[model samples]
Target: MNIDECESSPCQNDGTCLDKMNAYQCLCHKGVEGAMCEINRNECLSSPCKNNATCIDGYDHFSCVCLPGWEGELCDVNIDECFSHPCQNDATCVDGIDSHRCVCQPGVSGINCQQD
Candidate 1:
């Protein structure tokens, strides 16, 4: 097949089978984690953390858990600096917890609707 076809092959989310070199490589996705990328890494499978902790995905590894008002694959979900609360005086909302921003009204300020 072609490279595009190989890249889009249904070799599983974590495993990748390349036909060029007559071989395959495992490029694990965010959640799934393993040496060969064969094993489905269940972030919530093990009770590693205490309390109703949440598992967060990481670059190479994962975090233990997250604190209150926090979320993410690796508890990296920080407080949205531009949440709704940041808006003022009928201002519109702007950036959210993640990397999202909102449109502002005519008399709004800041990256989003901060002031008017």
Candidate 2:
């Protein structure tokens, strides 16, 4: 009835309360939705990421930051670091997390097997 009801800030979490005819309406912030703005919306409820990536909730949405050895919008693609053939001296190139490993042959050594 009176605006004083909303003045007391019945809404929680910094919600804005609008006084109505004998009642009040709470305008909740992002990620919060309810009659009294007490419910927290799960941003990751729909599993927005692919390839088992982690989802971090944002203000009104979410972010899918891909992990190592993975890339793309949903982390569905595996990065091939050995595409350029970084290994030398007949070494084997193995793809790794944001990198590559050169498995040296019988007589080769060093990172890319460049040294004998």
Candidate 3:
């Protein structure tokens, strides 16, 4: 007389339960694990986000909250402030970590080389 151990749906988080010899096993689904698949896998464990960006975990996925002067899916891109042409008066723009430098063409002045 074998009592069905899987009679009761004890598995959680969409886990598959396999009845064994007076025991049961739960096969966790994607992005989940634990005795009953109750734990959500931490996608941020690997630090996928770049440049001090915050990592948000999701169902089998992750997202990055980029800091100022950064962009892209993984926050890997350094925002080019020069893209908007902040440097006026025809200055050479040099990209930096999180900022841009305007090399004023001779006789030009001001923070953005806007002055003459």
Candidate 4:
């Protein structure tokens, strides 16, 4: 007697099974792999981020979120907040993490040396 492979629904993880000649084919889901769709693909396995950026894995995809003082698609670019010289009155501009600190001159105060 020819036993039907698809009768018992041997496919797992919501995979679809196609019966062939004395064999079967398992069509796995988006994030699933392997013969019976038993293995879940690891989205973070390739280390998609650069420059020490954090990688968040998702369904069949991943995201690279830059850390402080960094920006870009891969977080490989350094953000320079003081490039525009935000400090006024000759105040020193000290670049910080995702921000800048204005070292005001003598008798000067406030973030951009706007106040005494």
- Write down the TM-score of every candidate: 0.28, 0.61, 0.83, 0.61
Q: What TM-score does candidate 3 reach? A: 0.83
Distance from true location, Cα of 52 in model 1, Å: 7.4
Superposition-based RMSD of candidate 1 using all C-alpha atoms, in angstroms: 13.9
**What's the residue-level lDDT of 70 in candidate 4?**
91
Off by over 4 Å in 3: none
The residue-by-residue lDDT of candidate 1 on 7-27, one tens digit each, is: 555456546554555455656
Candidate 4 lDDT score at position 52 = 83
lDDT of 2: 0.86
Candidate 1 overall Cα lDDT vs. reference? Answer: 0.55
Q: Pick the winner on TM-score between candidates 1 and 3.
A: 3
Model 3 scores worst on lDDT over the 10 consecutive residues at: 1-10
Off by over 4 Å in 2: 1-3, 58-61, 65-67, 83-85, 89-116
| Deviation from native of the Cα of residue 94 in model 3, angstroms | 1.0
> Residue 43 of model 3: what lDDT?
94
> Roughly what TM-score does model 2 have, to 2 decimal places?
0.61
Candidate 4 lDDT over 4-70, as tens digits, reads 7887888888999998877788999898899998887887788878878899887667789988889
Candidate 2: give the clashing pairs. none
State the lDDT of candidate 2 residue by residue for 27-64, as single tens digits. Answer: 99988888888877878889988877999876567878
Error of 3 at 22 (Å): 2.5
Q: Which whole-number lDDT from 0 to 100 does residue 110 have in model 1?
A: 66
